[model samples]
Target: YFQSHPAIQPATVVVEDRAHPSTSELSPTWNRTDEWYNYRSNPRERVHVLAALDESSYTGGTMNGDHPIAWCQDYQGGRAFYTGLGHTKESYADPAFRGHLLGGIRYATGHTQADCRPENGYRPLFDGTAESLADWKQAGPGSFTRSDDGTLTSSGGMGMLWYPGQDLGSYSLKLDWKMASASGDDNSGVFVGFPPSDDPWSAVDNGYEIQIDATDVPEKTTGSVYGFRSADLKKRDRALNPPGEWNTYEIR
Candidate 1:
């Protein structure tokens, strides 16, 4: 599917050994033969991998489903899009859903016409850089360290980084993300319309958080613009590569 879709390139791909179930799937009494699980559970490794992939392909998001749905971000600002509507053969044949996916790709890849209406206009502020890390400095009291494996890790409460010097008054901000797993509440998401001085918590209180948590309540999963509106993702699948794999995300 990727090779044929030349307009969309595979940025950072992960081909994990699928012969075994994830550690979360194994019982404690089982042989416990998977050492890879230990390596994957390391936060520093995870962040490094995420940052590396993000830098390489301009993709930042998770794919928790069993099927391969491309999560992508636009290099330009103002739109983030995801479509979990690719699990079934019938869905693959649905023109409307396919249009949505293609539209998202076009928007992210810089091929779509922009809708400049106040409510729909997107003005990109941050382009994802080492300087962007400065925004998180105010997040307060978190350790930022590179692991032996070269992944960046941050522990403690939530932190955030946003494009500085902009107030998105009436633009639409889209985020595409997936949970790291099918169970447990390992939540992560995009924070939108936040004040430059604010942290993730303030964004949650004043702005909005479009949740990517699949296990969250239906109102909060996939396309939900956290606490405001819900995306109508009718079907669900869990064929995504395990947690350590790269998932694409687009936030406009």
Candidate 2:
């Protein structure tokens, strides 16, 4: 019935994302006694994670080392929020806890707003539209299908979508994507660090690719900087949403 199980104990809460209204008024290190619960999975990139539990501060930490205690997500029709606090009857009596609850409520109900956007630095390159693709140059075979809801899906891509307009050195790139395949296996990658070339193979030779296919070996799978560095599978697997669901990737 629950993905996270609870434990009645004390914890030192640490603010992970401080820009949010919920964590703005609270102290950076909050020491409180509450029934902390560890989720079977983490909803990191899937939500605006306001705060997290310092695993070293307590036990029953089943979420490996990374645990998200407070997070909020913008749903299809409304917003949803979850916190690993407020288990005991005396929790509501605490003024700091009450303030935290009020702040969360205000942001959820649109009574106040915060910059809930993910990936702090980086301008949008392609906004999931065919129109946005004008800024990009397609080299080689296959194409990406632009959907009405603003998602670009790979059609038959042995090709490359290259942003010829800019030469990036130190910058962050972020995009939200979902594969159509049910097996959680798809073929695509966001290529980087290469010069503008009409031939996509040049990027393959000189630049780097962040793999999207999950079926490959760890070195070449999703979150891997193809052939160069392997992602920390333990952390990557915990952070990933299932394939058919929209997932946000922040490439720095």
Q: Could you tally the backbone clashes for each prediction?
A: 19, 1
lDDT of 1 by residue, 145-224 (tens): 53332223445666654556555564545321224454635576677766666455677788777665666676676547
Off by over 4 Å in 2: 1-121
Indicate the residue-level lDDT of 65 in model 1: 20
* Cα-lDDT of candidate 1: 0.39
Give each model's whole-structure lDDT.
0.39, 0.73
* Best-performing candidate as measured by lDDT: 2
- lDDT per residue for candidate 2 within 119-222, as digits (tens), equals 33345676545667788878999886665545566767579777878677887776655566788788778888887888989999998899887788998988
